[model samples]
Target chain A: MEYQRYNCGNCGACVAVCPQQILKLNENQVTKDPGCDECGNCTIVCPLGAFTWKVGHEV
Target chain B: MKYDVVVVGGRIGGSIASLYASKDDADVLMIEKRQEIGTPVQCAEGTTQSIFKILDMKPDKRYINAEIDGATIHAPDGRAIDLAEVSCENFLDGTGYKGYILDRKVFDKHLAIQAAKAGAEIMMKTTVKDLIRKDGRVCGVVAEHLGETMEIKADVVIAADGVESNMARQAGLTNPNKPGNIGSCAQYELFGLDIDPHQLNFYFGREIAPGGYLWMFPKGEDTVNVGLGVRSTKKTAYQYLNQFISRFKGTTPVELNIGGVPLSGPIDKTYTDGLLVVGDAAGHVDPVTGGGIHIAAFCGKTAGQVAAEAVKKENTSESVLKRYDEIWREKFGKNLEISLKYRNAADKLTDKDMNALAEFLEKNKIENLSKISAIKFLGKHPHLLMLIRDLL
Candidate 1:
């Protein structure tokens, strides 16, 4: 299955809805700094479809 | 005055719902009980790096607490399984969002701001009293603002209240949670203990959390969020949580946090005439993991988008709202269902089983525990594997 990635130019749109605060923008690029727990909020919150994961990957 | 949509709760679900509706040019009003967003954080605040792609946004360093390089899994018997492998290539070099720990207060307020920027009106310190139905159909909501009763009419209403969603029940949707389907959690934010910044830990077994688990997510140098969750069955969740919290006696003294997690899947039905329920209020938490943040937002976005479509169609009936259900099933319901099935199987696992599972992890490089990997691992144990296979 095709994975999800947004042509996001480092806009902080997905970061806004993160309950875990995992998604981060560093050096004007989107990054997940250190404290990620795979809550998936960032993926669902992004307006540009920038956050994507393999459907059958490990949870 | 009537609006296109009225969202109760200004949290992620509510805010995202408003954003979706307003994006379609629908007038949306979001109400929050708190003066500020994301205060008194109720979650473990850990999320995968890839979640940002789904939201089309990224967080900054300001909200991040640490970078997790790997996770350590401890079985009921205290055996450990540690994995530092990053499945995503280039993820470690910062080319991709690695993963994050966050400050929810700033994060939640930011979501509210984004919703407003998307043209949704937000009201803080506003509480919904009840759902207004006309002819067995939802038409609006009755709310209290600063002790004053006010009636607001909307073409559609979205319920995003976390757990214990009174609004959903008042709207006539069947309650989806029972004691067996809920998990209670208690945690402490300790500041004095030196913790490994790159390692996250999960301890499991009936002794620590029957049908649940315990976790340690380090925030920074000498700080970590230590907590435990126990399934709410015959034991009252409060009783179990209090006893569990006291176990941190020799560790250190710090802030204490308590909350409940709905392990049941969403209600069989999540829509009614002119109304839709999203997030925890709809019981969309992950059954196996007790994580609801992503599922809730995904539900919220779908609800918001579908509600917008209903407004545009000029049909706010139960049938129209049912479309949201279809959208959710297409996107998240299947995975959630699978997770719940896994949870049921996990619930049947004994402390001995947990010890064996932990030892297995320590022995093998199943690396990260994915649903498929877990199933494959249990394949050798015919009885347990068969049970899980049937459930899955």
Candidate 2:
């Protein structure tokens, strides 16, 4: 998954729903720690559309 | 350090739990990750008057932004249905009105102060990175503050952590929710608005908020909270919010609040040996409307009272702590279950269905609506009857 940091609110909505528990929010920033299956949960729950599919994962 | 109770998260749930435990003569400590208690407001800030009743305290004017008396529900086709003041606590169970819009920044800090006054020690900017488990029971937390790590010991550890909660998962009480079950919310506090300050407004349509609805809650005469919650939508909640706000010609946002609400109802269980989960961590939110502040406060107070009693008895085992689950569940569990079922049925409603329902409501007194009236209404709308037949 890719992130558009400008639109990111760093609210941790992604962190809450991430099954892999790979996303981290600290000091108003969200960072990923790999091992993502592109479940698209972040894309769906994000208020700011900061995350997008990393291509080819599209149905 | 050892304490009788350790509560994670410094929001409404944590503060209320700490307050009650301390008031009950149990030593308590609350840990918060943020530098301040409620710097960035996340909620729409509307809550029922019963919140004050639960706290056993009067409503303080310092944190109340508006005292609401009524509400107007706007349907997709622009039909407005007004609701008067009621005794009901929330929208899913009843209609609307008799509420207050709180300034959470002030309200949260005030709650922390109340906890402090009750002898509960609080630590801001302290993050609980992990729970300390002995054998199979949670008994403490491994926390980090200013890059320094320490293990704080407790007989009962209450997880009041918010939606991004890790403590509850570690205790094996809950799992990550599906995207469809989370309410992705975004809001803006606007400075210029022309609307009834004492009357709340809600706009509904898929084009507006998808699975949820748009709300305008007045904070002051000239300012209002405009927000919306959406679920499983192609467009982001922020995008939808921006689109809705564009209609207002001169309004400018003074603050932006965004967060996720757990709308799947309370978890299956909220207690284990030496562990109790409260607030959003336990999904103590209304599944239909995504409101949890008052519920969190109520559950927090219950957890605190229960934990303090368990501490006095020198037994914080699951057998004893499970009483916490039983108490709150008995009081609120059935309501949440019914709301979840209603939300599922409402999810299938189209704009036409909502408009039709609004039309029915405009002519009829929603407050006096009974099962017979609902059946009669459904008899006319077969499409809606098919969608909500089981719910009836």
Q: What is the interface RMSD of candidate 2, in Å?
A: 1.2
- Using TM-score, give the best candidate's number: 2
lDDT of 1 by residue, B1-392 (tens): 57899999877788888888898889999988666777556677776664455567776776778877677778878787664432334332232435677666677777788889999998887767688889999899988777788889999999987765656777768543454565656566876656678677888877676768888888877678877667533343334545555655556646655555667787888999999998877887778777776667777888899999999999989888898898878877887888788888888888877776666666555455477766677876666666656784
RMSD of each: 14.4, 2.2
Supply candidate 2's per-residue lDDT for B72. Answer: 84
> Chain A structural similarity (TM-score) per candidate?
0.58, 0.89
What is the CAPRI rating of model 2's predicted complex? medium
- How much of the true contact map at the interface does candidate 2 reproduce, as a fraction? 0.72
Native contact recovery (fnat) for each candidate is 0.00, 0.72
Q: Any runs in candidate 1 off by more than 4 Å, and if so which?
A: A1-59, B84-98, B233-254, B366-386
Whole-model lDDT values for every prediction? 0.70, 0.90
